[model samples]
Target: MMTEQDTEILIVGGGVGGVSAALAALERGRRVVLTEETDWLGGQLTTQLVPSDEHIRVETTGRNASYARFRDLLRSHYRAFYPLTDEAAADPHLNPGAGWVSPVCVEPRVILSVIDGLLRPFVSAGQLTILLETRPVAVATSWDRIDAVTFETADGAEIVVSASVVLDATELGDLLELGGVEHVTGRESREQTGEPSAADTADLLDMQGVTWCFAIDHRDGEDHTIDRPARYEHFRDWRPSQLHGERILGFERAPEHAGDPARAYLLTPNPDDDPFGIDVDHRNMGGAPELWTYRRILARRQFQPGFFASDVTIVNWPMNDYIGGPLFGTPDAAEHRAAAKELSESLLYWLQTEAPRPDGGAGWPGLRLRPDIAGTADGFAKVPYYRESRRILAERTIVEQDFSVEILGDNAAVSYPDSVGVGHYFWIDRHPSTGGHPGGGGRPQPFEIPLGALIPRRVDNLLAAAKNIGTTQITNGSYRLQPVEWSVGEAAGAIASFAVAGATTPRAVRNDERLLAAFQEDLVAHGAQLRWDSALRW
Candidate 1:
């Protein structure tokens, strides 16, 4: 049996984007329902076990208030629970002087608690309904509008949700696929978008590889040898020297502007712990065992005790990431997933058996996979960190021209008149491919989130609220960060509110200056920075 529920706005995907949208809509006094495929609410922050990875300037530069609220909630949670010195709370960024990004280094559990606390109010208010373990399987649409969405739960129960505005914030843009919306999957052709680095043709699923991250704790003088995976012998001999003989961790020359790669390493006693960073010359192997060993350098005795402790988190472990080209085009997606899992298992086995010990010993066979730590039955992350999604073909697709270093200029960046949000990250942490662009790497310039990107060319009642908006293959690298995802989500919520209140479509809100202004004003009131500035401005 199926039942239908109606709301003013329905947000699919209970990740940072979906939660942000739900909060925004609720604040606007609109009826909203947020659904998640998993039991947890916070997507990447909670289930994924990915410690926050925001640009340095997020606190000051990001234009999304919900993101800021998230940060505040994190700080408040830490204050209430952790036994931290007052200094830690006062200096939230961890780095005393670095205002670039607030590096509130925290544990995954703490973040999950905070996210749950933030959503409690809305749950109680009835304005927001959170349906967890619910997967949206279908979308019902008229000629130009979305009428309702149908979701299926783990128990085979189906529920139909109706809303005036549908926000596709799903990690993989699942709704966009179910709704029959036209979208690009893998990578776009170079000729199609004129992106210097675009692929030869448009492969909608030609997305950046997804990582299955996990945490590890190292205890001194313990033997932890996980069974060698079926593919262990292959990877053992197939060392990509770029990552040293260890098969995972390696270093490379920093950009010429940053300084000589050797010089970059000069300031460090332990190359890993040296605050002076190493330019990942080439991270081709997707943080395999070699890469995992490299990260182990950071867990020096000085930074924190337990260099020989019972448990420590080794985050950059080898895990699942679609390896050969785009995952969507792979002949056997399930086979690829199985192979990836084998690769991860192999890395783990290597770490437990062959990895060098602090005392020059061999292996830690006792290393156990902690699903409880990663919030999954498999020790890997709860969800693959999806780097791309079903982007709507919008009236103005945000291309590299809008964010390119050549176009935006050095020291001076462009700000869109219809800016909805802001985000800034390295131009592109491109995954190494056989035919991808080479030597075109450099620092990414600041970028803007225009209202135009949110407006679909033909869709009437839906707006993208995550990485699935209207970015070219090139620009997604920058806009796919956590803060930016929240920004897009916040903007979508505001737009949904406007659409419901004014009885108009997203295109109308974007095309009309008056309506856009009102929406922007509301965003500002909610703590978003709409305008740009020389410092912390994108």
Candidate 2:
């Protein structure tokens, strides 16, 4: 017999946001159903193979306490399991993947393990159901509410889930399209949102590049080179004119100033191995930095002698950024998806065959693809690292003015009275565009996550739980990070649980000040940071 299960909350994507939402709902004694397209639950961290790219101030400012707990659990797990050197074990903040990108950089699997731990108790209690390798096929919307969502499993079996509240936490906001939620995609004109840094014309296909990141390990005398990708030459020689006319490979980068010429560097040199310097000078500055250590998942220096021969780093660099257009939602989705994958594989091929090395050599054959590390046979990530998503047309659309430092001036960020949570990422650092038009970057300030952003103006029982929240094409750049997504999810989950139990819609909660305040207080109690302090004053 076909299965049709009913739940209190249905989260339609088992990514970082969906996982957070599920945890929040489960904690509230709500029966939750969550589905993921991939086997892995952690999206960018695990399946996408993109290590944490966070701000430097995270050490002092910290994130939502729930996320903090997860981070702590990861470190604690490493401390308990790994054979750490005295020096390594002595340090309190142990970065398993001592990558320069983020202080808490670790392998995707390490994070996946911790996430499993977070869900196990709820799973055992029968409050949560995790459907892996499942995807949303159809949605049953009754007037304004999403009544049921049908998903096809890996085994071709169909499972339908009915819920009071549905959360669209899919990576690309897939449910928005499936459920016919009013959403926007790609570049919005400066006229559309009325903030600086937006394009002059709306280009629906002009979204940020998606990187199909892959992890690798280097062993000197080992040649684990796979077959040369089909389009290796295309990516090697193909540098967008937007890149100021330089090859995609090598240290080639377009100058921050558009009129300036292209520049090349093997990697940003950091003799001190200081992460602060890297974050300020290279990472936050965009372009490219020390390629190898940019997102190293496992640094040999972090472990004891002979424990690791070389570091394992994932390449999500300029060369591999698929800037052809928004592939997931557009008409050319399948064709572009294949091209994106080819672009990544081809970049890897180029790295193994023709990349310039500091040692006065071309290509390092020893740089081997580690399929086992990322849990993918081809060594590429299980999914692409999407920097943008189809955002909902909400009660409030966060434009550049709310957070851009240039526009907001000394304030840098504006506060929302109906705030649900808080997130920090200074600046709108947009990556390469699909049309080969590079977008601008500017640092913003710590921003509030307004509850209105999560509430679709038209949808009654649906809430945006991931990058699908109300954000313009420009503002999406900053709000689309790891911590911000978690905050969004946590808030959505909490609000959904409350709405489901209280017999009200997300819209009702936002409109009612008392209910909103109560929900915010509950979020604060459960580790959702609602606002910044005077110390973070811009």
Candidate 3:
């Protein structure tokens, strides 16, 4: 069957950025059509099985107000519905998982429910339409403007959507390739980008690794081991040069301590330490030398005594990072994705059979997979956790020097006259790549998202909404975080709505001072912070 639809704004990915863009557009009274390849939205936070990775100042400052509200809603949902202890429910800063990664590290399913609730009003009012299990297959373009996009549904139905503005929010930037929007993949050479962290030569296939995350809970004296995967041996003994010949399935791994050699990590579940003893704002408390609590999604201590048997944690460690091939722009994309899943499964098997214990023993056979938490038949997340995307070449490509603290000094970043929003990260964190580029971890200063970065150099009616915005491989490391992505999507959505109302192009909005100021004021009115406060600097 074939169908056609028209809208004011078309968002082609339902990750954090896509949802934010949809809300922003719908609030501005523009009809929106949002599509997602997976059944669930909230890509990294839900389907990808990763919690919100945020900066220390995210709670009070250095973040978009809308993003902050999303966090508050997640916490409020737990307090309102879940069986939290009075102490846990009353704490203003509730760390559900008490995980080191983010303060709001709850299960992926909770995020899906909260996001659906947030979009429910617009959806019922008919101002927003959401299509799940749909992906873009082709793009209609003429004279540097996207005319329409054809999407293939899960059941083989075709739906062609035409919109005045198209936002590319796919995790891998699928539209950039299908629509022929000029984009750059992998690391740019030092000579090209002038980045101190850039490689001497460019390798298009050197993109960061992707992980297939899963959740597990431990039960003592019970065997819940899964059947061994078919390719278990391949991953058990397999290792790339990035790990210095150490098996990736083992506890000792490289990049454990930044600027140091490989170190051993332990697997201790449900330690006796009180989860409430730690302060929410302290980052160091979660950095304990144990694997189980690193990304814990459910801390049993947060509930009443005997309410839960065990804590649930997500397995997204380096052991499962698949760097054998890139997911986009490759013939072996399916093979690579399958291999990544196998790697994660093999890691689980190893943990259940051979992982080291504190009492000088082998295996914890009690580790069980929680498919319900992931909302999938299998325990693995519905989609791989992607770290890099096909970034568009835009009017202004943010570079490493623009925010690297080592180069710009502490509390300093390049000033942008057309700043749309701000984002901050502790470091430029990059995972290993297929092209043998060991991941980088350089400290970074708080940065701004330039309006020019959202506008494609030549595409008239398209915008980069997610990790696909204009940034070099080096700078993408920090800009790709959750809040930053939300900020970018919000800015893109606001720009599209403004362009439609003013009957002007995004380029004209940037080129004309009067239009740019008015557009920025509109963004401010929607609770977006255009710049960071002086007190936020380190």
Candidate 4:
């Protein structure tokens, strides 16, 4: 028997920075509610499916105009409902899964149908409410604000809400450990963030390692193998001494730059050999080494050749990366998220039985498992893609020399006069950890986002939109992707609608420089770029 409500902005993780902080606090009229532990709302692009990794001049410059209108409403929902192929319909940047790891690689139910058509006009003018599957589980607070939270729904009940401005936007910032705030979980040392690639000590269980992504297609003579994983021979004879031991369900890994070495990829899936440029660039990681068109989302030569015949792909490579632990606050966090969904069902039963093939055989029983492109019946991805969170304790934390291209070699990143947004990556990708810590990628230099890293050194109104800001676990691996969590959730919903229309406080609009230049001029009159233009670098 628990109910209660009230809102001015509550947010709590609807993901992709709580739907860009409830579309920047319902286009600044406020009164939002948000919530969502996934019934789908584009968190990591629809229930953690992961695609929009951006930057390399995202179409033409550093992003955020509401994340370029969510990549222009996902290429206007595949040009207003797919069928393409007139040269992929007059190519104006249509990469609808011509995927070499994202240039708008479509489908996670078309990013939950462009985030339900951009929040169905603030949930039909009731000024947004959302809820979906819920999950917050108690907060209340007082001495430092955050007066109520509670949640817990997907059937169980209990509601509670109450808000003045409390973003957190979950995905592991679970209301900064249920509102006691002052965060910072897993990995912090090189003497606590002097970060020469950290970890000379502090290891709150290291972190980064959460995969569980899925979605496949294939179909040659059809077999669809599945149902083998009950710890399929313990992840098929697992091997990870930080990968030198290899056998990460085969297909071999370790070599997207950080001190390179371990190799062996090539999955092919559609290759008729050479000349297949789909235009990649996740700093060359997806510059195609061919793991089935590396995250290909649809591309049947961009539709219309007999209306498609299997080209969908998405396995989030590094052979189903589940560095064996950490999915939550640990106590073996539900057996490490059920052994990372049994190592993504034993890497789809070792790619449907022993991989290898080239005219030489092994498996692929015509691959399968689409579950309507992972809206999930059991095909995975309804969550589990995180690359680290629970960060705050902020008042500006972001280290790794504030944007290391080997310690700002050419100089950029670290501007912040309370900056507010802009993000880039090409390094500091970090992924192998569960305390084993082999993660690597390291290049970095394009960053920005600092509104004192989304406040919170003492909570006040609690912001930190996603990947729980105020970085460092080596800058939360480049501010944890998807267009920097949609510009750190449209700058925490335009700083909770300019601190609830100026009763004022997000650390008094970031220590008042005349309320931080009128909230960065209302976040650049609602387009929110904040900085990063000086002839854009990589």
Point to the candidate with the largest TM-score: 3
Write the residue-wise lDDT of candidate 3 on 361-390 in tens digits.
888899999999999898889999999999
Superposed on all Cα atoms, the candidates' RMSDs to the truth, in angstroms, are 5.1, 2.2, 1.7, 21.4
Q: Candidate 4: give the clashing pairs.
A: 42-46
Clashing pairs in 3: none
lDDT of each: 0.65, 0.81, 0.89, 0.81
Error of 1 at 497 (Å): 0.9
lDDT of 4 by residue, 220-306 (tens): 888989878777887878897777677788876657466766577788676542213665666556422778877777878776776
TM-score of 1: 0.84
Residue-by-residue lDDT tens digits, candidate 2, 202-284: 88788888988988887777677779878777777886766767776657676878587566655421122532233432335
lDDT order, best first, reads: 3, 2, 4, 1
**Lowest-sum lDDT 10-residue window in model 1:** 262-271
> Lowest lDDT 10-mer window, candidate 2?
268-277
* TM-score of candidate 3 against the unseen true structure: 0.97
What ranges in model 2 sit over 4 Å off? 258-262, 267-288
Q: On TM-score, who's better, 1 or 2?
A: 2
